[model samples]
Target: MITMQYRIVLPADYDMAIIRKRIAERGHLTDDFPRLAFKAYLYADRTAAYAKDRENLYAPFYLWRDTEGMNAFLGGAGFAGVIDSFGRPVVNTWSVWHAQVATDLSIATYATREIAPIAHHIALGELRDTEHARVQEDVERGALAAVTAFDPTHWTLLRFRLWRNVVEVADKNIDVYQVGHISQPSAKHDS
Candidate 1:
């Protein structure tokens, strides 16, 4: 599977309600979209979380069934609509490793996103092992309801999570998407 996302940094004074409304109205347009795995429409207010100097961001995360699915979405109307509203977004993708979501996704009302540079000299096995362990630990702590870890290229690594409550961690803070409104892969299996 493939994971994709891009962010739009809103001007500091820009009203976020506009973006929130956009998500409310059009975020789920891809619900049953062809080859879609899942899409999470996310928003973050820099003043609310993260370094005070950060800008508000609207970022949507996706897990595609395959490249066909990824290509279709990017070239499809949904993406076009996004560009019309937010301008062109720099799309990023990752090879997914483990994705776990609890049955009640709606409860995932909070989220955290962390992007960090990859350590080029690190052994692949070590990196994978460390990431797997960290994700598992987050789940065990009840801090995360859904999590997806990626083997990143454009970025060293990206970690995103749907959370049950406020996590003390300083990662990017995001508004949780409503359940049923979000979409996920139809079938699940080990990768």
Candidate 2:
């Protein structure tokens, strides 16, 4: 099976009430794509602040097992829109792909190619910034060690974004570690 993770960050000035309403409305409409494994709305704790030192809003985490199907679903869902936050629009979308190991390396190789560009781009922009350098460094070191110790089949792509107003009001920064892998099919593995 394959897994794809998508993350979207709302703008600082976005209307939380309206956004939540819209999300709720769409959630009901997602029945159109029953293949979607999981969808989650995540918010920062009241005590956390934005990493970019801007107002914070809740971040949305979406997951799917059918890569091609999910992409097609999103492409036609009319999910695009702009929100006002802190008098500015600060929205972004990011995605990651994951696939299980089969007898061949084709799946992993394809995922690597499809996901590497976005990962590298985000790493260069957000992860490498001075504000996030330490965290990025730690992640890189850990990721390298993990990859070395285990096969790439166990690895998964993780994409995340930060929202300003949501972070500030919610008083919590975005939490990437807890977003994906929540709905692993394996019952024994409680991801």
lDDT of each: 0.68, 0.33
Instruction: List model 2 lDDT by residue over 21-93, tens digit each.
Output: 6555554454334455444444322223333344334554444555665566555533443232223233223
Cα lDDT over the full model 2: 0.33
Q: Ten consecutive residues with minimal summed lDDT in candidate 2?
A: 105-114
Q: Which stretches of candidate 1 lie over 4 Å from their true place?
A: 49-53, 143-152, 171-181, 185-191
- Over 1-191, each residue of candidate 1 has an lDDT whose tens digit, in order, gives 77788878789988878877887788557756778766777777766643345777787888777899899888888889889987898998888766666654545656667666767798767776788887888788785344555554554576777776656664344333322235544522221
What local lDDT score does residue 32 receive in model 1, on the 0 to 100 scale?
A: 66
TM-score of each: 0.82, 0.38
lDDT of 1: 0.68
| Models, CA RMSD each | 4.1, 12.2
TM-score of 2: 0.38
Model 2 Cα displacement at 81 (Å)?
5.9
